[model samples]
Target: MINPPALTLRRRSEELFNSAERERPHKEDSAALLLFYAVECGLKSIYMLRNNLRSTDDERANAQSARSFSHNIVNLMIALNISRVSIRPAPPIVIARSGLSGHPLVLHEAWRYGEKVKDANTIYDWLASLIDWCRKNR
Candidate 1:
């Protein structure tokens, strides 16, 4: 199976992006979480579509699409753009996710309002960029 319509993925992204926008001012933590999912799903959907793969329950397909599941947004972006990175600094240098599974930095709380995530802009921007790319190709 290959190249599902991806309507579900797009809808999910829209839902999460909408939720994040609505709650950004007061509930940045939860909003960031939603935005994170939005981008990840968007990227996976795009990547799968480009690769002639299905968006479904197949284990291999899921694993391929979700190769960057454990990464933070920055590392996730880096992983998505894997071909661009050349220098391998160290363990924390986070170049990709499929092989190394780089650990997320404590730069922000995953699901909590902490001092680290004072602003949701970074998360929002990343999500927005992913969504924009999806619009063009997915």
Candidate 2:
């Protein structure tokens, strides 16, 4: 099971993304939301995959891959919102310790944008794109 801090970050990130999606415009907002969602999914996938690995396999191998993937995903999310502020602290240590930094949705947003982009153009577009992505992905 994921820890409270990590889980809270995920839920908060999802909520922020959802809020952005509903109130914002389209395109960029959707992309931002989708990017976060993808990262979140990728993080979860890596965790499940790692847990299923053979006991004889090196856990570090799976951890490394998951870490790299998560880092990239977080970077993408940051790029999507250059003006946001982070609600959480550095890289969200809880998730990173679990090799799930790629899924630090809340950390990225809170650290980057948080509630700062309440009336930004990019946020609007990101929200719209998020809705479309959610429909297709779902």
Candidate 3:
């Protein structure tokens, strides 16, 4: 796996976020998928930046410890010491295989398979919140 630099990851998240915004009107599922990835990249960027991981080699060394996060945004946020209270009002987005009861599944791999997604607008808002938080912290 290519563990990109923090700046690269942040840039990717921004690009994906813009793409998600464009796709929202015509293709919600696509937007959700893009939002999921955008949040993932954003979180990872913040994590790396906070941890003082600037070089590709530094990212690779830490990549093993971060591998568990994968596409799990909740886990990544927790690892970054980000609490729900920190980015409140807007909930964190989770890209999961199955919707865990109680925690509303807003985005999932089903979107990648052309499945319709629910509450995509809310997810987009959540991404905005996360991006804001990353900016403040970075």
State the lDDT of candidate 2 residue by residue for 1-138, as single tens digits. 232222343444456556545543554434454445544543333343434422212245334323333435445334233233322222222322233333334444532442322223433344334333333332
Give the poorly placed runs of model 2, Cα more than 4 Å off.
1-9, 26-38, 41-61, 70-138
Q: Which candidate would rank higher by lDDT, 2 or 3? A: 3
Q: Output the better candidate (1/2) by lDDT.
A: 1
What overall lDDT goes with each candidate model?
Answer: 0.53, 0.38, 0.69
What is every candidate's alpha-carbon RMSD to the true fold? 8.0, 12.3, 4.0
Question: Which candidate has the top score in lDDT?
Answer: 3
- How good is model 1 by TM-score? 0.57
Against the hidden reference, what TM-scores do the models get? 0.57, 0.28, 0.75
Error of 2 at 45 (Å): 7.3
User: Model 3 scores what on Cα lDDT?
Assistant: 0.69
Measured on C-alpha atoms, candidate 1 has an lDDT of 0.53
Order of all candidates by lDDT, from best down to worst?
Answer: 3, 1, 2
Q: Candidate 1: where are CA atoms >4 Å away?
A: 1-5, 56-109, 112-116
Determine the backbone clash count of candidate 3: 0
Worst 10 residues of 1 by lDDT: 88-97
- What is the full ranking by TM-score, best candidate first? 3, 1, 2
Q: How would you encode candidate 1's per-residue C-alpha lDDT over 1-138 as one tens digit per residue?
A: 443344666677788878878988887667766776776667666655555555533225334543434345455455456332232222232222223223334423334433334334654564566666656656
